[model samples]
Target chain A: MDTGSSPKERVVTDQDAQNITRVEELAYELKISQVMTREIRSLTPDMNMGDVLDIFRSQRVSGAPVLVNGELAGILSIEDIIRALRAVDLASPVSKYMSSQVMTIHDYDPVIEALKVFVKSNYGRLPVVDENNKLVGIITKGDITRGLLNALQHVYHEEEVIRYRASHLFEDIISDRTSLILRYRIKHGDFTHGGNASANIKRALLRLGANPQIARRCGIAIYEAEMNLIIHTNNGGTIRVEIEPHQISLEAYDDGPGIPNIQLAMQPGYSTASEEVREKGFGAGMGLVNIKRCVDDMRLESSTISGTNLRLKIFLREKDAFADVSQQGKETKK
Target chain B: MKIVELVKLVNGTVLVQGDRQDRDIKGGFGADLMSDVLASIQPDAVLLTGLCNPQVVRTAQVADVAAIVFVRGKNPPIETIRLADQEGIPLISSPYGMFELAGRLYKAGLPSFEKSVDPDCSCE
Candidate 1:
């Protein structure tokens, strides 16, 4: 009856249209080119399905546009490829499998318009065309998501830099007595949280906009001392952290069996860790040596009764002083 | 060389289905050590390994390896396959050992990272 109603066209619901309008309004200032990938990889109609798969794998792309006579012909997507792989032979020509009626967007069009097409058709990507209807670019959900993430990160880093600048502005006013103290208790044999204290200090220093090299050196020194406390001590320990404008000092004090031979303990390949510890990717016998190399000044005090007290000082006054000291320490270790 | 050609060359079986079986493999790297794989293999290179642990798949994902072919007829565990699928990497299991599989692929025109002449190549 009535020739099956002339194969009724799929209708776009009112809600879907409304959602697209909102998307357009929100992205009114953004253009398709802003988020589209310019270097598009496309497929040819004559290429066999096997060739298509080869292109997909070598290029690490899930789908690609199909071009004919230097014009936009269609799109061959991953979903279509998967379906074809299951139903058709890999030797079939891609033209027989490509979606000829491809939905495309202009490169200069508003991003919101592309958003509408995407929501209505539920497509993963859209081919971008120029005025004369030639494929110029391709845009995927990944590109849009990455663009938004980069924009958000840029804004966040700007805010952090501004905040850091303001803090330095106040430092000049209170130049005489500004200091930050951080403390953590280290439990003996608590390998589960071995480097927690040092990690926290590193995070704090980074947030405060300290030079990355200085912060890294301080972190390394604290970590080595913390490992010593956990691996070699019996009665646990404490770490006191002090951060001044020009210097960072870390002290680890433990009430456990101390090192009997300080010189031997300072050697690069000397370790007293059990066999079980060595199997866990640690206790390489380079802990103290590495600590000494990372810091500007290091002091170790140990005795059988008083346990071990280690102080690591890193200077941040001269930008290159820490690096120079690191160089010297490394040569000495060699 | 195409991955399908590799499967035929080594008499291997494709375990987990991936996007493109026809993908071209630029080179092959054979190793059982994850660290060596990480330090040496380049992106889009196929890894030939006998290790079937989840870490193998994880390493491939991090290094952007195109595919992994398990040698010695070893099948990867389900967890490893799941990870590989999630990462969009293909998994192949070869009946041949690493040395033979590598030799077969090399003979089939797949280049190695070392850039040496194929043993059969008669050089002056």
Candidate 2:
């Protein structure tokens, strides 16, 4: 019985008086293990936090399986790093806190099942072990992201996959010639959201097709802006990112009591955050210095009555100014 | 059918309104991860997805999207909508299943974004 086009059918069939059985189908099909990279990155448990950070930065991996005597010792992830960094000083060994009890998947576990596990855990990579509990391969947050990307981008052309970064959207202006201004608002007392606004803009720039170097510079500068609020302000304050297409401007403000020594605070390793924040991978006292290193122009403003505010300006030489972006893209193989 | 017409077919409310009748729609893709969306989706497009977070709108902005249609009528939080409003992207939701919505859009003459238009192959 072929119904006319105008008559809408019940897609999700259920039991009722007249059981008209129609086969249900999946919206999108899944690919086999072929399209996914299952090779899990691992490190020995005895390695220190410095090693972990090195691996994360170099491999660009979100998680690593901790191998203790060839068995699944523990799992270390970005979240774990954040926790461990907050728990101890920078020099602490990673084994002191890497999660030993990790949730993983059998080789046969469906990707959707893995997705559910990740969603529940709020963690990024999943280690794949065999029935014998031996590490075989691993799946990353990047893998899942790739899977979903392939599913949704039905119209993407080959050329689109290899695309121009600026073809997307524009980020906040940093300079008039080559930079943009970035501003972020860090809500008072909200520790979790402090550096997010700045990171969001950086990631946003990456998505919008900005050059990676520009994005990183912006991220580094704004990261300092956000951290300054968390350090001196009674409550983490506000950060604003302003981009003038060619130039970038960043401003972070806090309602807390003002900084007595602006010059000292700007020095390398000059941190006022609790020892706890330092352990968590921040409060390095090097934040302000890092910002200065990233941007071409930087400024600061502080007041005891209202709040302490810091503003930074960065100028990115135009994309045409340097023909090197395409080369980096090719190397990253994105 | 045009996205404007499809918007009427579904129960989703519009967040960021934009030109709905751009004849450039070639296909649809749905996903929750913006990172992937950022890597792919390089053409005149419409994105079908359910996640209505601020990142979704920002992803669409970075993707240079034509419109976004939320499936299963999942209206996102208000903050997400506010962000979308700022981005000038339109959102549509439908009571229809993602499968039905996809099939309907395909059958009504919209081609898959990746669907080869070369008539020599003859899949059509």
Candidate 3:
């Protein structure tokens, strides 16, 4: 049978890719102990088959591990119980009907390892043993599913809580106008932390409920400005950002070794960067140009005697506003 | 296209399988200049570059790049790999040059991530 082509052979849909990756990552990340059933019922070898059936029926469990002297000796499944009933030998001890060979999994092993064992064997459940060889729990396929769902929910909850708290910032304030200001001091030639400011800015915007497109545009714009400070200025620069309900303003400025020609610097391919800087994958002269594309307003000021200052702004449309004005308006209506 | 298929097409080796191997790459962008990449490339596109450095991962993070493919078998240093893993950005190295890798991905229907820059229209 041609068990269909590999997943790599076909283009994966966005939803499918996300779902498969989440589950696959969880399977390897979660340990068997985290998901296994801790309170498991075990049967003693000397218990009669009829008594085992009564225990199984009352507990609503189809199978259980059998212990001899507190050591795992076998597993008695529903199938074994059926065979005992077929022979009308309800009086036989569980040891006579139970499968003597048992498969066990270590509690510290990842859930994926348990899945591999389950696929290889026909057993409905595997007894989980700790490092000391003591049976700690039991695991089934259902447990894996529940474990994955809980992990997914936990991640979702964390992000949602952060977003919820941030999105409410503007709503709690009482003022004619409210704004948040963020400032960063960038050091020259600090390639190691070049984009750190921009990444944080983008994350803040996202948590504040800004749409992704707005966050991305601001992120790219600030990243370019931040790199300029690292690559060009004699000393480092300062980036200042002001965020309001309707607009965002960003400014970057540095002292001396200013742009000699602002017009030429604005051109796409113009560059004054040395060979050393070029080899490190920067100084293509597209920084200002890229920043222009992402913002609504762009300004450049320079005097070789003093310094260079660049300013950018993005205006948010009503639909794209992140502040909780609508929620405040609803409260006022009551 | 999925990142795994693109990796196979370019004869690439994964240096860091950040977050997921099956991440959906919506498009492709090839550039050695990080500024150009930050300016023009759209989000979720795979980046192809010959410059192997930690900054490449940094640029990918700021630009929301889905993955990075180091062309011409350029192995980025361990710093780059560690940064990518921390940020959950997939890193791959391809034996093929930028031109060849871009051509194959384009032929395989991976759209270009960049918007054409119009000369007449001032970006400002």
Name the best candidate (by TM-score). 3
1 versus 2: better DockQ goes to: 1
| Poorest 10 consecutive residues by lDDT, candidate 3 chain A | A11-20
Q: Candidate 2: misplaced stretches above 4 Å?
A: A1-183, A320-334, B1-124
Instruction: Rank the candidate models, highest lDDT first.
Output: 3, 1, 2
In the range A233-317, model 1's lDDT, one tens digit per residue, is 8878999988765678889998869899999988756888887665533466767766776677889999998888999888776
For every model shown, the clashing-pair count is 0, 50, 0
Clashing pairs in 1: none
Model 2, position A165, has a per-residue lDDT of: 47
Deviation in angstroms for A101 in model 1?
Answer: 26
Docking level of model 1: incorrect
Top lDDT model = 3
Q: Candidate 3, residues A1-334: lDDT per residue as tens digits?
A: 3222234343333322332244577899999999999998999999999999999999999999999788999899999999999999999999999988888899999999999988897878999999998999999988998998999888779989999999888766755668999999999999888888998899899899888889888988999899899999999999999998779999999996999999999988899988988998888888888888889999999989889999999998878886655664566677
Model 1 TM? 0.41
Chain A (alone) TM-scores for all candidate structures: 0.50, 0.45, 0.73
Where's the lowest-lDDT run of ten residues in candidate 2 chain A? A18-27
